[model samples]
Target: MSHPHSRRVRRGLIALAAVGGCALTTLVAVPASAAMTGSEKAADPASCPVAAEISQGYHDGHDGVDLAAPLGTPIFAAGPGTVTESGPASGYGQWIRIKHSDGAVTEYGHMNERFVNVGDTVTGGQRIASVGNEGQSTGPHLHFEVHRDGGTGFGDDPLAYMSERGVSLPCTP
Candidate 1:
């Protein structure tokens, strides 16, 4: 007759294997973009904040804010994240884009020089690029954009987001 102990052992092994499989899946299920170290996720934009106000301007059929600065003005990381894209992007001129762990991305465009390269991890205040007039710009100004999760395909209105941060914009009546 088959032993009851052996049946119990086989059942226990199957249960353990199932749990192990699930753990592996959980680890692998996380996207590479979302998998960030603790320090990277805790970045604050105010620390490496935009030190200048935006010049009134419009781009891509939307009103984008411009950070007016002298050429070669240090551009800091808006948030802790990895540089997924860097270099000239047609209308963007010389630009650097960081993808944060929260899926929010920041774009710094019209740069005179790029301090970081692609795949580089940067914290807030870390210099990523320099401001300049490039692409389709009117003058030396940094075109700043904050994009939401999976919203990197297009630009978002910085006015709305900046307003939420207690930055009031002048009403153009």
Candidate 2:
């Protein structure tokens, strides 16, 4: 035979426990959600270097795809990386190479102007250069390439590589 006051007190304690449990769950869930949000930002799709369709696809002896944009169109870094090379080449005229954390390297060639220098760290989508008709290019365009082994090996199909990283560069089938 519990007293009325005792019953009221027990109900109050139960209610308080339920509220405390909810608060605890919310506290635990918030940090997890925050961590995921941070990861999403880090894993954001690599930016397309140029805002133009692929003028040329990977085939035959072509090592990279060309994006035909007006001369001086800004080119961005496809992903976060450190600039390993940024200088004139025999065939590329002006080129920039970035080594990513995954050991892959991205190359941008025929740039009218390069904004970054060797050993410089750049973030994904950072403006690194601009389109140009430098080197052996026929007209103004950006030559983009991806290397699987930090530019030591042959180039890979950049379209497929960018696609795997959730970037859909404008291109025709």
Candidate 3:
């Protein structure tokens, strides 16, 4: 039998690891069945982006639709656009920004990895980045923003914008 002190040390170690792991990756718990995906990978949902309910919406000054997805889930470009910004932003971790044909720019934030770069042109539904728990994110998700009138901050509601284009979310924002 192990000493009492050794047992206590083992338990302490396990507890510390658990806390650290939780801090590193916020599991955006969206059930596979509850998420909606327009991509062909629906047959293999594991590779798709499953947007969860907007935990935080525009009204709260969140500025984007928080789509809770698994870490590394591919984030597709919402429309055809030219990549304007790619890489880390203050609170947006590894992010990507695209300027669409409408002169409006969209930003994808908290990405684990980015597939595009500044000045690169991307098509609708093109893979741009993977979901992650970066920046101020409490959980792994894609913080997608739609900025209109060539502005920064105070953008349009991403849910309404994407919904108009036919990308359905599991819950209303």
Candidate 4:
């Protein structure tokens, strides 16, 4: 999409869609990356969103795990869901949020780039974005969070929750 004509056409379509009062959804077909494995099943919150091996961990009151990764490292989805939001959010920087069928919503923040868009269906362990230092981040790492029962805030301890679901966190304290 580096060509000027391509960009112009895209912009023109977007403007036309807006004037028509329609939500412009540009569907992007993404191939599965090597970073992902295993098919999604049951829509359970039992699987790890990121790969099990993490550099950092979780903390008390921290709703998600901070996984240290290099910039542009692909980040995968933890479970099957529909993407609800994917854009810049305060303190989240560039983020992608998915609402799972099991009454849970998961968010991945501080990404350098997002591959999917709103209304995209994502499976567990599917590549969704590339890790980056964005928003309220100190370095290049992914900030992952899960909110239960479709709530927006007041996230529970992801370490304990993941551990109970059989996914271990790197946190010791």
Residue 157 of model 1: what lDDT?
57
1 or 2, greater by TM-score: 2
Kindly provide the TM-score of model 3 when superposed on the true structure, using C-alpha atoms.
0.66
Instruction: Give me the candidate number with maximum TM-score.
Output: 2
Model 3 stretches astray by more than 4 angstroms = 1-53, 170-173
- State candidate 4's TM-score: 0.66
Instruction: Please provide, for model 2 over 1-173, each residue's C-alpha lDDT reduced to its tens digit, 9 standing for 90 to 100.
Output: 74423422443455566777754333222223212243554564567778987789876478788999899999999989899999998788999999986677999999999999999999988999988899999999999998855786457778866776767887321
Instruction: Tell me the TM-score of each prediction against the true structure.
Output: 0.63, 0.73, 0.66, 0.66
lDDT tens digits by residue: candidate 4, 1-173: 35423423454566577698776635322233311233332335455555424655544446577887678877887677899999989997899988887667888899999999999998776889988899988888888777754746556556644554456664321
Better of 2 and 4 by lDDT: 2
lDDT of 1 by residue, 75-140 (tens): 877657899889989987888888876667778788988989999998766878877888988888
Q: Give one digit per residue, the lDDT tens place, for model 3 in 111-170.
A: 998889999988776788888899988999888777754546466766655554555654
Model 4 worst lDDT run, 10 consecutive residues: 28-37
Collision pairs in model 1: 48-125, 54-66
Backbone atom clashes (below 3 Å) for every candidate: 2, 0, 0, 0
Supply candidate 4's per-residue lDDT for 88.
89
> Which candidate order results from sorting by lDDT in descending order?
2, 4, 3, 1
- Candidate achieving higher TM-score, 1 or 3: 3
